[model samples]
Target: MYKILAVDDEIEILKVIDEFLTQAGFMVKIAQDAEAGLEILAKEKPDLLILDMRMPGIGGEGLLRELSRKKIDIPAIILTGYARTDAGLGFVKKDSLKILVKPVNLSILLETVNECLRGKRDGQTKDPDC
Candidate 1:
């Protein structure tokens, strides 16, 4: 089972994500904000991270930048309520699999998670010649 870290300031959002991802066969961890999320990341090192762009302190973009600086390569799917213009899409790198604008469709979130897990698995399996 894939391990996932889901971070959002809203308690309901964290609960929903935990329930949905757990039902989908992932081991899910929840964090209320970016600081908590980073603490969890330090210990768990989840296979994927689901982040909310807007939070009380150390927002998603800042967390992502910190992760990058620390050389953490975990794949991420960011959730944002703000408009793309205000949020500045530049924070999301091309390597990130998805950026879901709130309110997110559950189906799309599930699909993105599956796709990211698949990509991780595929990357781990390599041809001997390559």
Candidate 2:
């Protein structure tokens, strides 16, 4: 099973993602904040990361930037309530497979996750359907 790490400040959202992804046969890990997420990322090394763009401190973009600085490459999906053209999104765009606006559609999230994993297995940056 593909392992997935999701970081979000919203506990309810994390619970929903965990339940859905787990039901879909993925090993899911959730962190309530970026600091916790970083720890999990280092220890678990999940196949994909589903991150919320806004949080208390060291938000999703910050986390992604830190990963880049540390040379850690992982497929990512950014979930946000903000618009696609939000200025904060510019930094992490290159590393993200998709920028999904919240509240996210679970089915679409599942499809995107599958495509990301499939692309990784095929040694591609992204799937054609992504």
Candidate 3:
């Protein structure tokens, strides 16, 4: 099973992601915030990262910047409730990773997980089956 680390400040969202991804046959770990996520990233090195775009202190954008600076190329799906503004777009535009607007659909999340784990990067498109 592919290992996934899901990071979100919202406990409810994290719980939902853990439950759904775990049931989908992906091993799941959750971090309540980006700092916690960094710790998990260092140790677990999950195959995919499901991140919330906003959080307290060093939000998802900040975390992505840090990863970029360190040259860590982990595939990430950034979910945000906020409107798709330039602020949210700036960081994600770099790697061709798509941002899923929240609240997200479970099937799409699974599809995205599958895509990222399969090494799909630049030039990714939506799976119609999802």
Q: Top TM-score: which candidate number? A: 2
Per TM-score, what order, best first? 2, 1, 3
Could you give candidate 1's per-residue lDDT for residues 1-130 as a string of tens digits?
7899999999998899999889988999999989999999999989889999888998888888888788777778888886572345464455654678888888899988887777656776212211
* Model 1 alpha-carbon drift over 4 Å, by segment: 85-92, 123-130
Error of 3 at 32 (Å): 0.6
Per-residue error for 24 in candidate 3, Å, reads: 0.6
lDDT of 2 by residue, 2-118 (tens): 899999999999999999999999999999999899999999999999999789899887888888789787888889998772465455546455778998999999988987788
Superposed Cα deviation of residue 126, candidate 2 (Å): 5.7
lDDT of model number 3: 0.79
What's the best-to-worst order under lDDT?
2, 1, 3
lDDT of each: 0.81, 0.85, 0.79
User: Between which residue pairs do clashes occur in model 2?
Assistant: none
Which has the higher TM-score value, candidate number 2 or candidate number 3? Answer: 2
Query: How many residue pairs clash per model?
Result: 0, 0, 0
Most accurate candidate by lDDT? 2
